[model samples]
Target chain A: GPKVLQIPSHQIIDMGQMVTLNCDPVSNHLYFYWYKQILGQQMEFLVNFYNGKVMEKSKLFKDQFSVERPDGSYFTLKIQPTALEDSAVYFCASSWGGASAETLYFGSGTRLTVL
Target chain B: QQQVRQSPQSLTVWEGETAILNCSYENSAFDYFPWYQQFPGEGPALLIAIRSVSDKKEDGRFTIFFNKREKKLSLHITDSQPGDSATYFCAASGQGTGSKLSFGKGAKLTVSP
Candidate 1:
């Protein structure tokens, strides 16, 4: 039962400020991902990072959103000059490698409220 | 394109009753079909999953029936309990090795006593 932990479970930021949401994934996981879910909408794929580089991303991953695992500690998602539409539940997930099998372990998620 | 679609925005069932959730998808290469359960303020946890090679996979009260030809699936919970209430999402992913989850809109299930 591996667990993914997220810091600052909730955050409120101004419309033009920067916010960094953090995640600590399972120790043995090699794959990492970020997913966003707007209120009352399905969870949408954002971006994925592994081996210190982005492997793939979806259309929803915007320029304002950037992910980094500085010092290989915390996987942080930073939003610069946040907009009203930036508000959503951002989730972090990690999984072990598989030829066609990536079983993800997700965090509780950070609820971002951009006002 | 939206690869996955689930039915019933919400559902309510009494204790000891059976709950069935349906889902459909557009991707033919998607080999893994999984169902995730989410409580009020928690993350979605993997409940049950099935591969295209299998028609059914059962674990405890949760069962996943997958039809690869139709690209459809269903989750059946037998003798449901109140603790089983949660938002259930049907997800599908292709033969990739990363976050290729094409998720459905999700279905909310509430089991009352």
Candidate 2:
């Protein structure tokens, strides 16, 4: 099975600081997505990106959150001046086509802790 | 409000028995349903999926029974094993929704040997 790799499996940052989570999606995947999951809760859709543009985003994607895949490198999620509620496990997923096309491959996840 | 709902927050079944997980959705526009399995410390993995046009889908021991009119579905796992203990998430997506999936809170299953 193809795999998506997420860097820094665990991160602890102070509130109001900027934090970036990186994901290495499958080499041939075209669509990338970010999802957040609080402890003992459902995974919530945050945002999806395609061809250097945001295709869609949920309300959970706050104004402070941004995503980019510069120069075909790692896909990154950056949160500036983070809030305590931002602490959660972030999972990155990738697919060959859009949501209706194929199954998504998800990374192990990056656990962000805000203090 | 949660668009996707799953019943039995936790379930316990004996090995070799059948385990049924129920799910219902509030959105009639959702045409795609996918069930995911997640173990501790790991990301969710796609177990099986079905489209609105189909009433049932089977893969190995896993089967999904879909009722389009009722907007309900269930995942049936036959011959349950201890290794199958994990959380299952039911997700739905509407057409041209840009691949954004609305997921249920999940049902944790424990298969005892």
The candidate that wins on DockQ is: 2
Q: What is the lDDT of candidate 2?
A: 0.94
What TM-score does chain B alone reach in each candidate, compared with the true chain B?
0.95, 0.97
The CA lDDT at B28 in model 1 is: 79
TM-score, candidate number 1? 0.96
DockQ score, prediction 1: 0.56
**DockQ for the candidates, in order:** 0.56, 0.78
Give the root-mean-square deviation of each candidate in angstroms: 1.4, 0.9
In Å, residue A12's CA in model 2 sits off its true spot by 0.6
The CAPRI classification for model 2 reads as: medium
Q: Compared with the true structure, what per-residue lDDT tens digits does model 2 show for residues A6-114?
A: 9999999999999999999999999999999999579999999999999999998999999999999999999998999999999999999887767888999999999
**Tens-digit per-residue lDDT, B12-76, candidate 1:** 99999999999999867788888989887788889988989999999999999988888889999
Judge candidate 2 at residue A48 and give its lDDT. Answer: 96
